[model samples]
Target chain A: MPHITIESGKLTDEQKRTLVERLTAVSSEVMKIPPEFYSITIHEIDDASYGIGGKCIDLVKQEYMEKHS
Target chain B: MPHITIESGKLTDEQKRTLVERLTAVSSEVMKIPPEFYSITIHEIDDASYGIGGKCIDLVKQEYMEKHS
Candidate 1:
């Protein structure tokens, strides 16, 4: 069985369900396993708790938005 | 930010804490990032929900134990 876990910013329940379904579909198709045999979980995280290049994602997003918009 | 998600059988709170700490330590060391900037999430799964090679992991583990023990 394949277990998929996604950790990211907050997601709505509907989004979580959709993500799980899509991930399960793709994984089952690629791994040749039954969809029911898959397990998927989502962990909602605060943007402050995640960082890249020593900068928080929240700050990165803010900077990107400022530059683009 | 780098988010680490681990999917496995049930684990105690201590186990989860230790896992998160260890994962963060190694990840920080390898990626040259601060440990505090890392996010770790664990998804505890039921054996029935996970399968491989068309067989549930629970069944596989049971068989292996039986054979070896």
Candidate 2:
């Protein structure tokens, strides 16, 4: 059984559903398993809770937004 | 990189923090890596969203509760 957990910043419900469907489609194709056999969960985390390079993801996102926007 | 994603039913903020700390401690002990080097994220999910054996988790929980209560 293939179970996938995706942890990322906030996403709309639609986005989550789409991700699940697309991921299942590709994964099933590659693994030679039926799409229904795969289980995927979307774990939406607040950016503040995730850290990289000792800085919170929210802060990092803000910086990235400033640079690109 | 030792990144872990935990997907489960809703948990309080305190519970989430405790889980992160405890998981890092145990994982580091087993992997022989420093605790600070591990990254963990908890994805709290609504029971209605997760499926188990063709039934949503909420429905399963309801059945379990009815039987146990």
lDDT of 1 by residue, A1-69 (tens): 456665666766766666566556644554455889767666677888876788888899899999999
**Predicted candidate 2 versus true structure: per-residue lDDT over B30-52, tens digit per residue:** 98887768777766679999898
For each prediction, how big is the interface RMSD? 10.0, 4.2
Per lDDT, the best of the predicted structures is 2
Q: Show the colliding residue pairs in model 2.
A: none
Give stretches of model 2 more than 4 Å off: A1-44, A47-69, B64-69
CA deviation > 4 Å runs, candidate 1:
A64-69, B1-69
Clashing pairs in 1: A1-B51, A1-B52, A51-B1, A52-B1
| Candidate 2 local distance difference test against the native | 0.78
Error of 2 at A39 (Å): 18
- Which stretch of 10 consecutive residues in model 2 chain A shows the poorest summed lDDT? A48-57
Q: What is the interface RMSD of candidate 2, in Å?
A: 4.2
